[model samples]
Target chain A: MSSPDSSLAEQAKAGDLEAMNQLVAEHHAAITRLLWRFARSHADLEDLVQETFLRMVRGLPAWRPQQPFAHWLQRIATNTGRDYFRRNRIRDRWQAPLPSADDAATATQPEAVEPGGDPAARAAAEEVKHLLARLAPDDAALLTLHHLEGWSLVDIAAQYGWTVTATKLRAWRARRQLRALYLSVTPS
Target chain B: MNTPPDPGDSRWDDLLARARKDQPAPLDLAALQRSVSLEARRLASARRAEAPDWTALLPFRSLVSSCLAGTCAFTLIASWQVWQWWQVMPWAQWVVASSGGAP
Candidate 1:
């Protein structure tokens, strides 16, 4: 849905302070939601959202507002989230839990599911996100935009800088590969 | 309740929908706006400062400028020499004509 922030967008484009403030205020939640899905970890959420806004302001001069302002801003958020992970991948791995000696000795054992409400649902969600993280960055972004964000093919195409047909074709390929990837990862 | 949604199928849409929860959000962006905008402006200025100078686009820019300065200096010197010759030419001709006629 197109956000009703066009007037603010127009004024922000001109560097109007009040309009920019209102515009950022208006779009923040949508930015958070977009980045939340796009982020590989919850820890990166705040930084990613902040970077998105910074990029939006940096890009304001070039934003013509022919399309919805939310679309433009969300595109920046998506890119920022992806870029944050890409840049931090090595650091993230470095920070990952080192396998303890006891854990290493029991490697062949079936892992104990963490105690939580509805282990099945939690496991499924965790698996989904894990599999999502394994997908090629573009494929993950495509799925998140199309499926998670419910963005239209046209919106996806515009925001991702692809033609409609290209977006469709790429999404098709991504989904197929993701299905295989999912099946391979999750227990039957 | 069943096997997880089939990827590449409509079932996956349900999984995606559940992931969002799609709550309507009215966020407070004032503090964030101020901070991010200030940082953005700072970065923009820094980027502008780090940006290449217009002259840097040309290889040997300083050499070209120096050549241009030398060309201007030569032109001015040549013009002055021509003006001096022009002024002295008629006088020399008149003196020759007068001296020849007197002799």
Candidate 2:
């Protein structure tokens, strides 16, 4: 028997609006959670989630039933997150103030910290974002998926359509870069 | 030579752990649904706008083919006229006289 998601996907591809909406409703929270790490605020999170679903709907015709729907959605969400980072980098280059070494050192003290969380965790998260912002978008995404999301190299490779060996090399390099950045920004 | 410590090593776990603990705020499901619906509608309308209207081009279909055919015929006729003109030219006569019409 075909899975419910496969069935829903088939209907959605056939232009069933309800099926599309159902798929969105079912996966909205998961996509939001995945993209939250990439977002700077609640509004950005919402926008990313919306973009992910829009891409999903647009891509329904190309989705194969052999692949799990959730996995496909996850890939789309990851890609959406990567695109968000790329756009942010471009915007930061033009509009945002240039971050000085001192600012990098004190990045943990983000002004727009989300209210009502474990302050330490929030600060750490902010620090992580700052460090990630310093790296290339692709490297930051690779580190986020592998380190923060606890995804294995093989899984990340599969999602990114890269070979396991390549993924391993990239992950190693990204980790080393992050470590260097962290050391530079951290006070002795 | 000493190798630098890996960030994936145990020492960096504490920071990653703390980062993981920073959960996202609860999403407004209704707002998300509304946004998706609006985007979907916008995309549908955009796709509709992009779709080639063959029917609208129906009137021009014959016009375009006629224009193409007319241009081809004009080119062929012009080429034939030029060939005829070349055959009767003074240069043609000279070339024919020089080569004894073997050319």
Candidate 3:
């Protein structure tokens, strides 16, 4: 919950390499994880992180201390992730073939090892991830920030500059959709 | 009797634990630090070498920005003026008569 300091921002703005390194270390994992989940590919993680940090470095000179640096950093990170998907959308579409039952099983189901995997659980995870991929980036982001990161609704609302009610509503709808996807993928 | 935590209930935690167990040995922090320092020095040198001659373009960039701003301001003001005139277009002759024929 504690955010980075203005002194750190100022140092990075002045091109302090140590400060830049510290900033990256502080937030890069969260950003990378978020992007990776959305991307469904680890290959995009490094590029997205680099782009986000580069933008942060460039925009540092104009940054004001009035806002939480995390929020601003997250905005940049999210936009960079979204831009990555947008640019490679077509290629990614061609590359990521439809999820097989096995692929779905591997990606979802909480990494439980059984004789093979509990087909039902794998089906559940795949259905969820597939449905999640179809969601708007904002919706996907909110869901991940809440469920995966275990962040409070208020924290997510503040981070994204959304009203608490709106965030909750979107999250609720997203969960419902994910459940529906899981059910649909289950062999009745 | 202390009950064991259900493995099924904590799959994510279990997976994370396995992942940590599978990771390679700890990185050499000192070596990493040295490499980072070296990269930093190289980046700094590169930046200095690629420094632009901003002094030469400062005047031109400033002038262009100022002129564009002024033109935009003028256009806005002119549009507002025309709009106001169109809204209350009293005849010029009638205005003169109302002012007692300019005495």
Candidate 4:
């Protein structure tokens, strides 16, 4: 028996607009949560989520029902995040703002933090984002998956289509880079 | 200023733990669905616009069929003319006569 998702996917592939909408509705929240880790702001999160679903719709014809739909969507979401990091890397190089003395004070303001969230955790999240922003985009994505998301190296390698050995090497290098960046910015 | 913790210390782990605790607010699913639907429609329309229209080639296709028919008719007429010329040749008559008037 085919799964409901598989049936929906087949319908969507056959150009059933209702099935397409249903598929997006079912997966939208999960995609949003997955992309939230990569977005710097709510708007960026929305954009990433939209792009991921758009890509899913475009690639529906190529998706096989044998593969789980959720896993396929997650792969698309991860790739969307990676692409966001790459675009931001280029934009930041040319348009990054100069550091202001009041930046530290502003970073912790209530308006700047998530509502009903711990300030310390929010600060830590900001720090993680800062450090990740400095590394290569792909490295940032790999480390984000391995560390923040608690994904295994093997799982990440599979998601990225990299060999296990290559994933291990990359994880090591990204960790080293993060440590160095953390040390440099820390008060001595 | 507080001294930074060493990379090997528990502080790094603590930081990662705190960072992991951060969660995004619940998204507006209805809004997202609308946007995705809109974008999907736009992409579909774009793809349709870019696809080659076989119907648009109907005139050219008809022109090609006519050219092919004309070429076949010309070839048959030319072959018949060549056969008529060959029948009137002295060598053609000599061959028929040599073969017991089998022309």
Going through the candidates in order, what fraction of the true interface contacts does each contain? 0.28, 0.53, 0.01, 0.51
- What does the lDDT read for residue A147 in candidate 4? 68
Please identify model 4 stretches exceeding 4 Å from their true place. Answer: A97-116, B1-8, B43-52, B60-65, B76-103
Per-model TM-score (chain A alone): 0.70, 0.90, 0.67, 0.88
**TM-score values for chain B across all models:** 0.31, 0.40, 0.31, 0.50
Candidate 1: misplaced stretches above 4 Å? A1-6, A65-67, A88-126, B1-5, B8-14, B22-31, B40-80, B83-103
TM-score of each: 0.64, 0.77, 0.52, 0.81
Worst 10 residues of 3 chain A by lDDT: A109-118
Candidate 4 lDDT over residue span A1-188, tens digit each: 88899999988877777888899888887787678778877777878988898888889989998999889999999999999999999897889763333353344333453553667776777677767877899999998887678899899999999999888888787787787766666554
Model 1's A-chain: what TM-score?
0.70
Q: After superposition, how far is residue A67 of candidate 1 from its true place, in Å?
A: 4.6
Individual DockQ of the candidates? 0.20, 0.30, 0.04, 0.38
Off by over 4 Å in 3: A1-4, A33-36, A82-128, B1-103
Tens digits of per-residue lDDT for model 3, A6-96: 6787777677878867776676666655554444333345456566666777677678777677778877876775565455555657887
lDDT (0-100) at residue A156 of candidate 2? 82
Model 1 lDDT per residue over A69-119, tens place: 776777788778667656655554577753433433233221253322333
Pairs clashing within candidate 1: none
Candidate 2 chain A worst ten-residue window by lDDT? A107-116
* Error in Å for residue B59 of model 3: 10
Better of 1 and 4 by lDDT: 4
Docking class of 1: incorrect
Error of 3 at A183 (Å): 1.0
